[model samples]
Target: MAQRLQSISAVTVSGALVIVLLLTLTFGTLGAVAFRADSLSGLSTRDWAAVRFTVVQAFLSALLSVILAIPVARALARRQFWGRSVLVTLLGAPFILPVIVAVLGLLSVFGRNGLLSQALGFAGLEPVSIYGAHGVVLAHVFFNLPLATRLILQGWLAIPAERFRLAASLGFGARDILRHLEWPMLLAVVPGAFMVIFLICTTSFAVALALGGGPKATTIELAIYQAFRFDFNLSKAALLALAQFGLCAIAAVISLWVSIPAGQGAGLDRVVARRDGSRILDFTVLLLVTLFLITPLGVIAVKGLGSVLSLPASTYGAAGRSVCVALASALLTIALTLPLALLAQRVSKLIEGVGYLSIAASPLVIGTGLFILVYRWADPVVLALPITILVNAAMSLPFALRAIAPALAEVERDYGRLSDSLGLTGMARMRLVILPRLRRPLGFGAGLAAALSMGDLGVIALFADPDSATLPLAMYRLMTAYRMDDAHGAALLLLSLSLLLFWVFDRGGRVNADI
Candidate 1:
C-alpha cells in the first residue's frame, strides 16, 4: 500500500509540473501572437535610449551593492556586540519591504526638501538632487545592499572554526586572512549576488517611474508600462516585453551558473572567533552601514505618525483590498509551491528548473502576455484582481520553494522509512508526522509569500483599473497627485502591515517548534 501510494504521489506531482510548464509556454505563445509586423520597426530613439539606460543602471546598481556589502558583511561576521542579532534581523527587512514605501522613506532623506539637502545647504555645499540615474541607483542599493550583506555573511559563517584557529596559531595577520580566507569566499559569492541584483533592477518600474526624473532615466520596464498603459499599443508592449524577458533570462542563467550554495551547514552556531580584523575599521563600517540602512525607515516612521489618522477613506478601502489580495496570493503560492517542493526531492533538475521559471521571466512580461491571452476571450479589466493575485502568487513561488524545499527533503529522509514500517501512508503519515515536523518552514514560507504579495506593484499596475487599485498603486497615485501627507500615511500603513504579516507567520512557525 505504501509503495502504491508513493507511486501515485509521484505521478500526481509530475502532472502538476507539466501544467506549470504549459502555463509558462502559453506566455511565449501569446507574446508572439501579440507582436505585429512593425513591432521591431516601432522602436523609436527613446526606446533604444531606455534600453541603454536600463542596462547601465542595473549594472551600476549591482556593482555598487556587491562592492560595498563586503566590508559590512565582514564587519558583522567578526564582531559580536550588543544588538547584533537585532541588526542581523533588520538586514532582512529591506528584501521584503514595499518598493513604494522605501521610495517615500528615501525621499524623506534625499528629496529636494530632505534632511541631506538642508544639511548640505547649511554647510555651504551644493544641495544635491535625488533624481535621474543616481536616485534609481541609490534606491536599488538601499533595497539590495542588505541582501548582499546577508548572502556574504552566510559565506563568512560557513568557514570552518578549525581553519581560523589554525590561521591564528600560524600568526596570520589581517592581510593574510584576507588573501586566504575572505577573498575566496567573495569570489564564490559576489558574482551570484551581483547577477541577482542586476536581474532585479532590470525589471524595476516604480523606482524608475518615481525617481527617473524623465525619459533620460527610463528603464525598459517603464517603457513597457508606457506602451501598454499610456499609448495602449499592445504590439509595442509585446516587443518590449520580449526584450525584457531576454535580459532577465540571460542574467538568471549566469546567476545560477556562478551561484555558490551559500554554505548551508550545521556549524553556524559554532563561531569562528577571528583574531585578524581591525576593531576600528569594523566599528566604522558597521556604524556607517547601519545608519545608511536604518535612517530611511526611521524617516518613514517619524513622518507617518502624525499623518496616519488623516488618511482618506479611500486609502482604507485600498488597504482592505490589498490585504485580501495578499491573503489569497499567499494561500495560492504555498499550494503551488508545496507540491513542487515535495516532488523536487525525487524529481529531475529540469523539473526543479521549471518551478523557478517565473524568476527569470519579467513580471511585466507575464502580465502583458496574460493580458493579451485573456483579452481575446474575456473582459481583462473585470478579471484584473484575480490576475493580479495569480501573478503575485507565481512571483512569490520561488521564495516559497526556497523556504520549504529543504525542510520537506529533511522530513522525508528522516521519517520516510519509519513511517512505512509503522504502516503510516498517505494522509495519516502527513498529518501525524510531516505537518508537525514541517511547521516552521511552512510558516516562514507562507509569511514570506504573504508579505511579498502585499508589497508587489508590478503586475497589478498593468491589469488594475482605477476601482481595483491595490494599496501600493493607490499610494503611488497619491504621490503623483502631490498628496504628500496621504502618501506618507499610506506608506506607513503598508510598511507596518508587511512587517506585521511577516512577523506573525514567522513567529508562529518558531513557537514551540521542534528544531
Candidate 2:
C-alpha cells in the first residue's frame, strides 16, 4: 500500500509546484513590477481618461446588452418553435468568433459605407462613421448581446413549469407574471450577467483598437498596448496593467456577490400551461434580433468567398502559425488540467481556483507581467510566440478544468475503489480507465480551447512582431493598410479554422465514447 501511494509522489509534487508557480507569476511578479514606477502617483489626465472611458463604456455596453436581451430572451424562453435550437446555437457563435473577425463583420454592417449607412444615404441621409466611442459600444453590444441573452435565457428556463402552471391557474396576466415570477428571476440573474459582460468589455482591446480611436475612448487594455508597443514606456504599461487587473478584481467580487442563486423548486419537466405574450411582439423581437446578429457574418461570408482561396501567402502563413498555436495551447490545456484536477481529488479543490486567475488578469496584463520579467533577461520579441502559447493555455485552463474535473470526479467515484482493488494505479489506471471515459469532455474542452486560441487577438497583439504575428494580427494589419478584401479573406479563413477546429476536436473519436 505504501509503495502504491509513493508511486505518484513525484507527479503529485510537480502538480503542486505548477500551481505555486502560476500564483507567483500571476500576482507576485506583477506586484513587484507595479510598484517599480511612480505610475500610481504619475497617472496623467489621459491615463485617468482611459480609466474613465473603460468603466463608462463597459457599464453602458453591459446595461444596453441586458436591456435589449430581456425581451429577446423572454421571447425565446416561452416560445419553442422549429429551428429554435439552431437559433440558440447561433447565439453562441459570437463567443467563439475571433475578436478581429467579429469586428470586421460589425464594420461590414455598420461602417460608414456599410449596409446601414448605405441605406440611410440612399434615403438622402448622412453616412455615419463607426470609428469612435459609438462604434466601440456598438461592437461591444454586438459581441455581448448573445451572451447576455443566453445568461438571462437560462434564468428563464430555470423557472419550473409547475410555478407557471400555478400562475396561470391564478389568472395571472403578463403584468401579473412580470411581478410574480419574471421579476424575481431578473433580480437574481441580471446583475451577474451585466457584471460578466462588463468585465469582458473592460478588458476589450481589439474592439477598441479597431473602432475606438482618439484619447477620449481608449481603454486600459489598449492603453497598455500603446504604452508597451508604441511608447516603449514600461512604467506606463505596468501601471495600466495594474489598473486593469484591479478593475477586473473588483468586478469579479461583485459578480460573485451579486450572483446568488434564488431557489427555483425542481419540477417534473412538464410543459407550462401559460400563454406566451403577444406572438406578434415576440416574433418581431426574434426576427429583428436574429437579423441583427446574423447579417454581418453573412456579409463577411459572401464577400470572402470571392477571395478566401486566393488570399496572399502571408495570410495562409499566419493561419498556419495560428493553427500551431491553437494545437499547442490545447495540448497544454490538457496537460495542465488533468494534473491539477487529480491533485484536487487527492488534496484540496481550492487549488483549482488558480486556473481561473487568468480570467481576472486579462491576457495583456499577463503579457505585461511576463514582459517585465522577460525584459530583465531576454528580448520579449524573441519570446513572443512562446508567451502567446503559454497565455492561451493558461486562459483556457479554467474552461478545461470545468469540463474535465467533474467527469474526473465522477469517474473516480465510480471506478476508484475498483481500480485500487485491482492494483491499478498511475498511468495504467489512466490509460485503461480514466482517459477512455473522459474522451467526450476532453474532446469538447480541447476543441473549445483550440477554437478560442485560433481566434485570439489579445496577447499576440501585445507581443508579436510581423514574423511572429498570428492570423488575427495579420488580418488587423490588412485592415489598417486599407486592404479590405484581403482582410475579409483572412477573416473568412480564420473563421473557418476556428469553427473547424472546434467541430473536429469536439466530434473527434466520440464514436461510442465510454461515458
What are the clash counts of all predictions, listed in order? 0, 0
Off by over 4 Å in 1: 6-18, 25-39, 260-269
lDDT of 2 by residue, 227-264 (tens): 88899888988888888989999998898789968578
lDDT of model 1 at position 78: 88
Report lDDT (Cα) of residue 464, candidate 2. 86
lDDT of 1 at 190: 88
Question: Where in model 2 is the C-alpha error above 4 Å?
Answer: 7-11
Query: Using alpha carbons, what is the TM-score of model 2?
Result: 0.97
- Across 178-280, the per-residue lDDT of candidate 1 in tens digits comes to 8887788788888998999999999888899789947789899899999999999888788788778878889999998999764423443566666676899
Candidate 1 versus the native: TM-score? Answer: 0.94
